[model samples]
Target: MGQVHQHVHIEWRGGTCRVKWWSGEYHANGRKRYESKGGFTDEDEAVTHGLDKLYEIRHGTHVSNRDGATLMTDWIDAWLGSLDHACTTERNYRSITNRHIRPFFARKTVSEVDVIAYRAFKKHMKRTLPSSYGNAVMILGMILDDAVPRLIKTSPVERTKRRGKYVKTHTRERKKDVAPETVERLARNAEILLGYQGYVLVWTMAVTGMRPGELYGLTRHYCYPFWPASDPQQDPKEADRYKDDKERYGRDGNRLPAIRVERQVQFGDGKREFFPPKYASYRTLVIPPFLAEMLARLLALHDYDWVFPARMGGCLGSANFSEDYWKSISDGCPERKGPRIRRPLPALPAVPDFKGKRMYLLRHGHKAWLDEDGHSRFAVESRMGHEVPGVEGTYSSVTVAMERAIMTTLQERWDVAAKDGWGTPNG
Candidate 1:
């Protein structure tokens, strides 16, 4: 309403009449915005429509035809910029949107994307990129949902697909969870190849259920030993860190030694940045006495802030760790010209048809162990840093008894590891 400008013009086209108009919009300290539309048969109609548009602009309900004609790729760029998601999520969304969504829909107008086009896109995704089909659709739906009231009147994403519908014939290869005994062998091989640090890393993951990033994010400051009220002597720092956990577990002091998961390190923009755990998966983890003792001894050996550091004294990047350390041990060191020639893999127990399983399998194995030990669904989910879902996830509380039971179950595994000479302090 600050300053309004308007213009109307007419043109004679091959025995036909055409009219065009422009509305110059400037309000307060904002930039002077201009809008124009052309190709109307009647000058009166063009003027009326232009005035209506100008009115809407002044009233703050303006819907721009130019916005409706916004290309999918441009809209996607804007949408991604507008979001405040974690860096990891931002990387993932960008990768998928650019790789899959853009090539097909980039040229189409937002207003022109109809159910027919959406159905074809969905069918194409199912036929060619079945594994990524669901995530692609989800990201598309999120964008369209935001666009509905602003740019487009309706979204073309199918209701069934949006609700997670899947065809009966399609299948995805599920990641296999290894047995706890197999994890022990993996740890033993890790020690032989990468030394004691590797051994402790794999063993801790198998029993503690900490995600890879969380494990890498661990610092000595976060590790806690059991400090029950019943015991008068305790590490002052451990007591301070476990204060909340102690109160939650009724201060009985019978709880297991624990580690606090405060942050995760992820890769982005050619560098690693520390971020909160994915999906806010922050929780305390309690370990058995043997692993706790080993960790304590390991901590005393170095003054590095990180509990597990790379060879050069910084956090271990997952990619470098996987390629240089994990793969060499799991398979064998690759052929080279010098002292780094190919080495034979140690004779670890073989699982038939095992196709180079990654380190994440240890986490899955830990969840399986908890399930096998008959822990409550709530306790298992809580320990795994997953929301339990429904009313139970909201109302349920993890009590001292549940934690003690989990501790006992993990202690049994440690006992087996001790006999196998896997998790000892000097390993």
Candidate 2:
């Protein structure tokens, strides 16, 4: 039998400070749970503290300093909340944590968690979740990692060749393609819905394949060539020159070509004003003539620096065409009162099928059309925002010409009216 332990208690007596410690044992699940040795100022307070610790221990909570250590759920809440993640991302994180990490590790101590436990947890997750559970494990690994070396013993996540090891499989329950024809219809519809501002947002992403966060981060200073006397070459990267290239920052008293994609507004818990991008995702793209012209026009009208926004519904907020725009118009069209709004579409990577109503289809269809038109796979990948795999299966690099080609192809396939208007502001 292990010796009874004690807990310290502090109190004031007769105008003097007093210290008391208590000793006790808690039993649960037919196991003995002991607390540190001592005498407390009062038996009740000591017993309560002892019982709480015991309950935690008997329930499989182990490792030193267990009571205060956060569970996976707590860690997740802290992480997502602290980052001010996007609405979609926060939603996804909650779903994955509750559905994946909590049920298994809710009571387990961070120090007690190991690869074996992780592997088993992953398999359980795979029973219904995607093989992407591996990806989730990686994310979980990250949260725990940030906590260790400061609060806990260490992070249990380590190198593991666990991809595709899940017991379940994934089918495309969501649209993997944005559909080409949908994009075409949306482009045509943009004129009447929200006008150029809305069209620019959708068109820019479709043509550049930039993550929505990156797209929202665009600024006039980067696109139109304004030089802070402190850094002149800073704007050249607006071309998105090469893979290893970073946004031109303060240089040797001279700026370089650059596009700064450092911030964006994302819908999160409370509609975050702006947030940082994920790793390897903060990047700028060279604008094409067609897309650049759209930028020029949009820039001329807006007072604040951003092109995709008229947040106060300025000249085009109510008019901008996004998923919300496409869906609202598709469902309300009077013509739909006669036909079922058949939104037929070809597969565009990442956009879903709407059977001829919503117009994300155009973005996908444009990609297919471009592939057939002699565009390189790299170009297609850049435009579609699809990850490009390399020789060892690593992702390929993004380049300015590559991004430019995406816009060019999009113009040929969907921007028929805007095609004639395409050209650099300087050109």
The lDDT of each candidate is 0.71, 0.52
TM-score for every candidate vs. truth?
A: 0.75, 0.49
- Candidate 1 local lDDT, 158-234, one digit each (tens): 77544446557456557665655666666666666555666778878988889988888776666644233333323
Q: Residue 175 lDDT in model 1? A: 67
Q: Give candidates' CA RMSD values in order.
A: 6.2, 12.1
Q: Which 10 residues in a row give candidate 2 its minimum summed lDDT?
A: 249-258
Error of 1 at 244 (Å): 3.3
Model 1 — which ten-residue stretch has the worst lDDT? 225-234
What's the lDDT for residue 156 in model 1? 81
Q: List the residue pairs that clash in candidate 1.
A: 228-253
